[model samples]
Target: MPFLTAAVVLVGALGLVNLLLTLGLTRRMRQYGHLLDGLEPAERGASTRPVGSDVSPFTATAVDGTVVGLDWFREPTLVGFFSPGCSACKDVLPGFVAAAATKRALAVVEKGPEPADEYVEPLAKVATVLVDDQAHEAITAFAVRAFPAVCAVDSQGVITETGVQVARPSAAVPA
Candidate 1:
């Protein structure tokens, strides 16, 4: 009877230790999750470019190595920042292509020197495609912290709308 009671106590103590260890591990995991959340701009709630900011001064190099400047934003334009390496960028590309038919569109492909052969022709069919080496100039100017971002620029070269998703503005029908 004495030996059985000792064994029971031992098992109970082991169980308690496991419970405490699990609790500690769970707390540490939550802390790690919060730290990871801060790593992403969207998860950290960071502000991208504010609406009404002008993007006219920004420039990106076109596929043909021609300099595309602010004049491209003279009309209501949709500017998309994308990367061949980003899965999210590839996912939204079809929508970006669809939006191009309704508006003037430009796709700024991030991370130059990487072969984006597969994405080039499709994006070029709908928009002026530009390759941004290091994405320093255009990304910094537009305050784009994330790939697959889309912004609507008004005729005055001011950003009227912005989002991670590419969507076309609603058009008014003739009465």
Candidate 2:
């Protein structure tokens, strides 16, 4: 009878330990969730370069044969990185075009298995377009880590804002 009582006590002690461990684990997970909630998209691993960084020097040939480099951004410019087969890139293309309509913009398209004509045709209307194959000079220069990354850069080549969509210029009110 004593042995049976000890066995029961041992099982109860193990159950208590398990409950305490589970409660600790749950509390830790909640703390981690709160920490993640405090982070911004950029801090959470979005692929675009962070704001306040300078655009690295790079020279790439646009479709029109223009040699584009830091000098090209003599005015505020919107730059977008894209890939041919990325659905997200396609979804954001129109928004990028609209945002680039009245601003200096550059579109860098990474070559994929499919043709880039789908992306090139419309983007060319609003921005200088570059189709990059092996030489990803422009892509590397922008520190682009994912497709469809966009950034608004100042004339001095410092990135002012960056995200999955171009930052539209605020409308000015006439005095």
Candidate 3:
């Protein structure tokens, strides 16, 4: 009888521990995710040779074998990241598309190796979808945590603005 009681207590303890771990991990994720929203630049790179500026090297290709350089944007560039299957992505599509209509360069960064073209069609009206096959290197480097987020950069390859969701449907609208 004592052995059975001990076993029940052990099981309960293990359950509690598991629950606590899950909660802690969830909290950490949420905290980190918040960083994805409106991440302001701490410092600027050298003005002449900027790497992650308004026109940085976002390694994604175009349909006609033309490689796109994110850093090549001399105008304001807006970058959005989303999953193809995310419902929230669909919800915000119209707004983003409408906004992209005005921006000179608006690119959508994808998470998978599925090639950017697959997702571009859906977002074509408002964005130039690009692939972040590994996701972490490009998207995470931007510190984005949410499903649908936007970033804007200026001519010098400097990040000027970032938005969480549903701001205003105007690319003419600043980040």
Candidate 4:
């Protein structure tokens, strides 16, 4: 009887420790999630990305190697982060390309040397695309947690909206 009671007490104490540990982990995760992912641009990046603040300003290059900066009151820009390494990016490329015909659309391939011919060649038809030299700038700048994500920014470089799994999106622009 004494041994059984001791065992029971030990089990109960172990369970309590586990419960406490779980709670502590949850709290830490909530508080430190940003450390793992990045800052909050507030839904400014992909849908999977964490959205914070209404807007974020960033500078990106064009396929033609022109530097494009998000302005406050100019025209709207649609930024798309894509990778040939990702299957979803390939799937969404068509819609993104189509949208570029009517609006400003960009795809980040990789920065430095131009992207592979296979990816950039097809995207060139529609997008004002560029390559991301920084592998995770989009994720950090906009908290884009998901891939094949899109963000819309106004002329002033204010991020208006973002979609995680959207094929086509509508954004209001000033005439």
Best by the TM-score measure? 2
lDDT score for residue 56 of model 2: 92
List TM-score per model, in order: 0.65, 0.71, 0.55, 0.57
TM-score of 1: 0.65
Write the residue-wise lDDT of candidate 4 on 7-101 in tens digits: 99999999999999999999989998778686646524345333234444456556686665444226776767676667777787777766666
Give each model's whole-structure lDDT. 0.72, 0.80, 0.60, 0.61
Model 4 residue runs over 4 Å out of place are 1-57, 111-115, 134-140, 169-175
TM-score of candidate 3 to 2 decimals: 0.55
Error of 3 at 144 (Å): 2.4
Worst 10 contiguous positions by lDDT, candidate 4: 43-52
Candidate 1 lDDT over 61-142, as tens digits, reads: 7776667677766678787787777888878888877887566877777764456765677878877787646245677778
The global Cα lDDT (0 to 1) of model 4 is 0.61
Error of 1 at 120 (Å): 1.6
For model 2, the run of ten residues with the poorest summed lDDT: 166-175
Q: Rank the candidates by lDDT, best first.
A: 2, 1, 4, 3
Kindly give the stretch of ten consecutive residues in candidate 1 with the minimal lDDT sum: 166-175
Better of 1 and 4 by lDDT: 1
lDDT for model 2 comes to 0.80
lDDT (0-100) at residue 38 of candidate 4?
A: 65
